[model samples]
Target chain A: MITKSIMIVGVGGQGTLLTSRILGGIMQEAGYDVKLSEVHGMAQRGGSVVTFVRYGEMVAEPIVEEGQADVLIAFERLEALRYAHFLKKDGVLIVNDWRIDPITVVTGAAEYPENIIDELGRKHKVYAIDAMKEALALGNSKTFNVIVLGAAAKHMDFAKEDWLKVIEKTVPSKTVEINQKAFLVGYES
Target chain B: MAEKKIMLGNEAIARGAYEAGVKVSAAYPGTPSTEISESIVKYDEVYAEWSPNEKVAMEVAIGASISGVRAMASMKHVGVNVASDPLYTASYTGVGRGLVLVAADDPGLYSSQNEQDTRCVARAAQVPVLEPSDSQEAKDFMKFAFEMSEKYDTPVIVRTTTRLSHSQGMVVLEERQEVPDKPYERNIGKFVMMPGMAKGRHVYVEKRMEAMSEDGGGFFVNRAEYRDTSIGFITSGIPYQYVREVFPEASVLKLGMVNPLPRKMIEEFASKVDKLYIFEELEPVIEEQVKSWGIEAAGKEIFTRQGEYSANMLRRILLSEEVTEAQAAQVPARPPILCPGCPHRSVFSVLKKLKIHAAGDIGCYTLGAVAPLSVIDTTICMGASISSLHGMEMAKGKEYVKNWVAVIGDSTFMHTGVNSLMNTVYNQGTGTVIIVDNSTTGMTGHQDHAATGKTLKGKTVPAISIYHFCKAIGIEHVVEVDAFDLPLLEKVIQEETERDEVSVIITKAPCVLLKGNHFPDVCVPVPEKCKKCGACLKPGCPALTKKEDGSIAIDATMCNGCGLCMQLCPFDAIAKEPK
Candidate 1:
């Protein structure tokens, strides 16, 4: 089993924390060792958050080193750029085309750089999608993270079926149908 | 088939507690750990409440635990500092019923006052610590924590790092169980922890640790994989996955029970590999333990000792050849800041412009210490603002500084700010405190609190007024100011700073998100009278964007229409559109 490091980056409230859990569930069920670490408590006010997901036969660290992530899943445009440098040269990044400037940018002390896709593309393979729009189209703006997760799977050895099982096992029975369909849309998109 | 639910780690702990027959739940909403009790209250079976602070919450849980049913309490890491008085004693006294204390550690200082790991607390209390890697484990371990609590007759700690608590995963929900209700069991010798009883309980705790390690170690919680011979890795918590990601063929010992670590498992694993590296985040708790057992491990040497450990860090530490130049850039050199339209921005701006040294407390308000605002001088945990301000003023004298306001959030004020206020009154120092009450915690996903008059489940609870609290604290003057009202806020702050005695100015505004999805109030462009002197830009509201003609324009799309810019506009170039 090849060691694969997945980094989930986004503004708080974008459900970045769930990525590690959902992804870990799939990895753990696949009989692979999974080690994940995330920022908790506080960073919840739409602050920037990053979660590190690593899985294989022998994991060592909880976080992905800068620029060492094999896959970068971003829920917001600015966060994609903020963490863009963490992607390895041969890595893949799936970004949602939404911008929520951080406090520094808001106070006019700094500005978000232009053309995040172009910048990320310079170092690694980049896919920019309006995941939030797709999620909104599906009637839940909150599921954008899961949509990005689906798009992210296309680049990895992570089995689509296994991810579905985890989702089925984890999602509430009341919203299972919607979330299952949501995951399918994300996977197929 | 058991029902499955999509739940966050925070929710899973509540689910775990409910299934474990938890009779009572209490906590103060701190990030990462807030949702545990919030979700517990959703189930009609358990009694849950939000205490004023973590110390109170801990005492309340202890009181419930003594009654012989299951009980649980949770708080963010630093919160444990407040509850330590009871936590240390409770470990010696042990528990009458199952008690699970969940302390969510925020590595990377995400939303906390500091990233003090709670694993240390577990070790210090001489209790068992279960660190769950995911939501499923979070749920399972919570129930297990309670079980271990009762079996060992001790308070068990389910230690969750921020990632494990806030992260959402698929949790297989269990049916809620009912706890046996009975009268309190009064065993003074065991519960009181008197010097005589304490010595006996202390020895019992040591014996319990030995039994738990021997029995629980062989339990599935701590397991080993014999994959390859050359290199062996010992790790636990979230880093276990990262180590596996890099060296797929390496032998590994992944520890689920972090505290009272499996000594037998470690020695066996160490003997198998030619070299060993203990991979863990924050501090070297596991590394130190292995070393104490006469094992030389490599960690915090090749890998970073600060912030958080990432997969990239693991690869570099274990497989150095795999790293590349582009990967170097991916590591964030700087930390994240607050977001635009943040409720804390205006208060910081006022403090910055006045050039007054402010003692800032934790919460979203701590961002005021960052660039542009840079108004805050010190940030020392929660409730330190008011007390620190009093100390600074008394030592420096009131006449020395122009502005010296203690900036604190509404939730933080209630958490420990009450005591700070009382100290300010007793000390009789002339200082001003700005309570930035955004109507929610605002820093930690806007969790409800005592001041909000709402429960986490959105039920109405009694609200505590900062104004009334200030008056009760013996402040001669107490007033409220709209934080977005720049001129009025500035005048009020300026006057309060000059006051001869204690004063408090409450900044009242509902966070834009909590305002119920109405389009944020926007500033209308007065295109005709625009000279664009750039005076409005001084306050640096993101809603105001400069145009090509040097005329300032407000993005009706982005503005919340607070109109502080209107007051700052020298040429009357800005105004708020009618609601």
Candidate 2:
């Protein structure tokens, strides 16, 4: 049984939790034993948030130890860089080309790396997408996560129809159409 | 037929409570433990409530249990400190029906003030503690805890750490069992805890512990798995998973019942294995007990008694494997911040503007101590703000308190600040108290509280006004002002500090992040009139940022337009962007 660990990294309120849930749902639907772990409370206040999703015949722990993640789905550029260690040397990196400056950077305590994508791309299999831009094209920036997940879905073994079906059940009925469109844009990007 | 679904450890605990025939559930919202009660509320068979604090929650659950119904109360580890008084006494008095207390410990200090272990508290109180490694066990152990509680006639503690509580795993759900409630019988000797009765009960407790210790060896929960038998790992709770992940072939003595130390099982496992290692997080509770029993086991010495444990950490410790270390990046730290338009931002901005040393309390307002504002001097605990301020005046004299004020959140002020304020009134301590009333418990994901005018079941109730409460509590000069009204708030703070008597200034504003609560107006910078004096950035509102051209820009999507940044602008360079 081959177990795959996917680390979803983003700032709080970026729908990272929902993304992990959708991935977990997809894996569970595929009859894979899935385990998802997330951090709540203080970390939800615009801090770095990482969710771990492990799926296979069985998963003992929900956490993805350093260098064990098969794929890294990052919602922000800097967040992708921050959790780069969790990704295996041959891991697939699906990063959103968006930078939300940290408090230290805004306060001039530190600088936001200008070439984070380039640096990550040089070392690993990096797929950078402007998920925020894609979501904006769909008329709702909140769908940015769905788009990122859509991009990640292309790399995964899951079927496209199955991803859409899960998204339909996972998201609200009112925004189903927009979210589905957003997911496609992400998948194709 | 049982249904299988993926659920968080907290949700599984709630499902367990429902299936275990729990009648009443109460908890004060704290991280990791908050969702247990929240999820329990969905089951109509159980009456669930969000108590004002953990102590009140514990007492309420105890009251339900004494009424002959199974009851459960939950809170984060620090909250156990608040609930410990009732817990210790309840341990002596026992229960009419079964009672379970869930103490979700945060070992890594993830979202907590400290990394205190709940198992230590359970040991001190002579209560049996159950630790679950996964969601399935989280559910199964909750039901087991209730059975053990009734069987032993004691309040059982279900100890879980952040990893187990927040993690999601597959759980097999079962039908809710209708356990008949035991009739209430008032026996003073058994129920009441007079010194004489307590002494007898204490001896009974000792006897119970001994019985549990002896019986624990054969209990199915305290099982031993022998594989290679060369390396034995004794672990419980989330650490058990790490041990299994790192050493799949090694023998494991996974003790589900953490307290009362399954002594015989430990001896048996220790005897069979050539090498013995204890893998427990936070405290060396098991390690100390095994050593006292004359069993040599290596634990805390190899694995530091701090933070959390990972598979890599265990592998490095046991096999001396060179775990891959990622090159540390000098990335800017993304510390948690107040939401873009948090009401606390305005209050801190005033405190910072006045150069007042504000004693802080726990909640979202504690973010005020972060960069740009930095007004908070001390944040010891829940109600430490008022008491700390009073202590400062007593130590440094009244003159020193002239430029100082204690700032606490509305929920925190209600939690324990009232008592602290009462102490000030009784002792005639003169220090200003500012209650940042954001209408909800903003810190713990906006759970409704007593002052929020809403119950756990979403029922509207008469909200307790903090302004009136302060006046009623002997605070002569109590003032209320909108948090966004910078001039008025500043004036009130200055006036309140100047007055000799203890005063309160309630800065009233609903948390912007609360659902259906937004200002509807977003402040946009007028680039033509902009002179980047950086004054608007002082509040550190995440929505407002200075561009490379030295002009301020607001992310319209992120900004709720509370207009706090607009009020902070020196020139008329900011205005509400038209919808």
Candidate 3:
């Protein structure tokens, strides 16, 4: 019974919740017990949001403790740096090369750190993809989260068909083709 | 055979209520608990509603219960404070039919003003409480809670935390059991809580508690798992999962029924184990009780009572493991902010320009106290904005509060602010009150309220106009202004403060996040007309950001073309771009 914990980190309204749902659905289809947990309400107002998905033969708690996540799927670079500790020593780090300035940085109270990818690359197995650019290339920036999820899917054990099926079921009917292309670009990158 | 499907804890509770044949359900939307009633409304058999406040919701549920039908009320932990008065009395005058109250506790203050333990309130009110650890238990315990309510003839409480309420897990679905409603009998002694009848009901409540304690051990919900007897853990709710995850080999007494302890089972379990440790979160309700039975146990001493508990916390406590701190680069704090075109942003901008000291209330408007537009001076609780402003004016003369105004939301104004506003009129106090009417409960995900002119089931109703309501409450001067109209809002604020009598300013604007409510145009920066002056960034809209070269650029994806930044720009650099 091998249990794996994945932490999805990003700013609110970045489709992190939807990504977790698709991921959880894929895991459930793979015949593993899965638990997905997230914070709602006040935290969704342009704040840093993190969701945890744990799956195995049996998962006890939905939370991922510090230094326990096997994979860190970050939708933003700064968010990737912020929640890096949750990853295990040999964990795979998949980060989108995008930056959303926090309120402090916008208000001149603090500075957004430089060289985030380089800093994380030195310690962990880092995969940096320009997911937002790829989604824009696909003619929709709203599909950015799916691109990140597609990049993350390459590291997981689930079949590519399972991921596509889950995506088709989760997303709306009209945008399925474009999202599938976004996922493929993310997976190949 | 029942199929297992993935469901959130809140959704599972709603399913549980539906399966239990609940005829009526009422709730005031709050985080974590809001989705329960929302999910229940999908079932056509149940008559569900979103009451104006928790107190009203509780009374509505109680009314249904007394009419010989199963009913339930749900709210967040803070909302229990508003509904406590009726809850306490309902305990004395037991339910005619099964009744359950769901209080979703926020353990880590994830989306709440305070982290409170609902178990303590349940004990104070002498109500039996059942705490569920996962989605399966969330549904199972809800059904069990209603049974316990009917069996003991009392209102049962099902306590959940943010983790359990928001987490998704597999639940085994069950068909609805159509339980027939009991016959309604007009027995005043049992239903009424008069002083004379209350004394007799109090005795009955004590007897009921005694019977429950004695027989609770035989119930299926309370169980003792004896694995390795060397060290035993007595835990319940979400904490039980953490303990099991951390110490899989240790024996545990997982008590689903939190209150009305099963004395016999506890004593037997204690004698079997060499060392007993009570693992619970937030409060030591169980630990204190076990200790009062002359049984020594380790609890709050090992675990702090401040925040939530986790497997890592338990591992650190028992194994003496040092938590590995991340040495990552410093990240800027990402505090929650008002959306790009939030109506509250305009109100806060005007209050900041006027240099007025504003007492804030709960909801999305509380974000006004944050940076750039820091106008709020104090925020104690819901509806405290108006009353606190009146108190300040009375304490430090009318001249001191000439620059002070109380800001509240439309949902909060109806929640309890109406009483506070009437207090100002009755006491003859001179203070300005501003209701930021965004049409819906913005903070809890835009649930319809009394003033929203819509029912929980999406039925249209007559919307209560806030301006007219204020005038009817004896306020002489009531003015309504568009929140985005900066000059008009500023002018109204200045005029109201100069006048002697009490006045109300209703800022009317729908929340930008509401569906189909966004302005079609997006604001863009005209590069040639730009100056490096930082005036446009004063309102702190997340969409407006400074480029690497120091000129401001609006993120077209984020901007809603509210023209607020354009109004602040002296160089006339910001303009609305055609879609």
Model 1 superposed RMSD (Cα): 4.8
* Global lDDT of each candidate: 0.77, 0.90, 0.91
lDDT (tens digit, per residue) of candidate 2 on B334-421: 9999888888888888888899999999987888887977998788888999999999888988888989999998899888899999
Question: Which residue ranges in model 2 land beyond 4 Å of their true spot?
Answer: none
State which candidate, 1 or 2, has the greater DockQ.
Answer: 2
Q: Give the count of colliding residue pairs in each prediction.
A: 39, 0, 0
For candidate 2, what is the DockQ? 0.77
Return the lDDT, model 3, position B92: 93
Worst 10 residues of 2 chain B by lDDT: B322-331
Rank all candidate structures by their DockQ, best first, as comma-separated numbers.
3, 2, 1
Candidate 1 residue-wise lDDT, A1-189, digit = tens: 766889998876667766667788888677676666566545554567788787777554445677668999998777787777777778899988876655565445566667777877776688887777787788877677788888887887867888888887776777666666777777787
Candidate number with greatest lDDT: 3
Model 1 segments more than 4 A misplaced: A1-189, B4-6, B325-343, B515-520
Give Cα distance to truth, residue B122, candidate 1, Å: 2.4
lDDT comparing candidate 3 with the true structure: 0.91
Q: What is every candidate's C-alpha DockQ against the true complex, given to 2 decimals?
A: 0.29, 0.77, 0.77
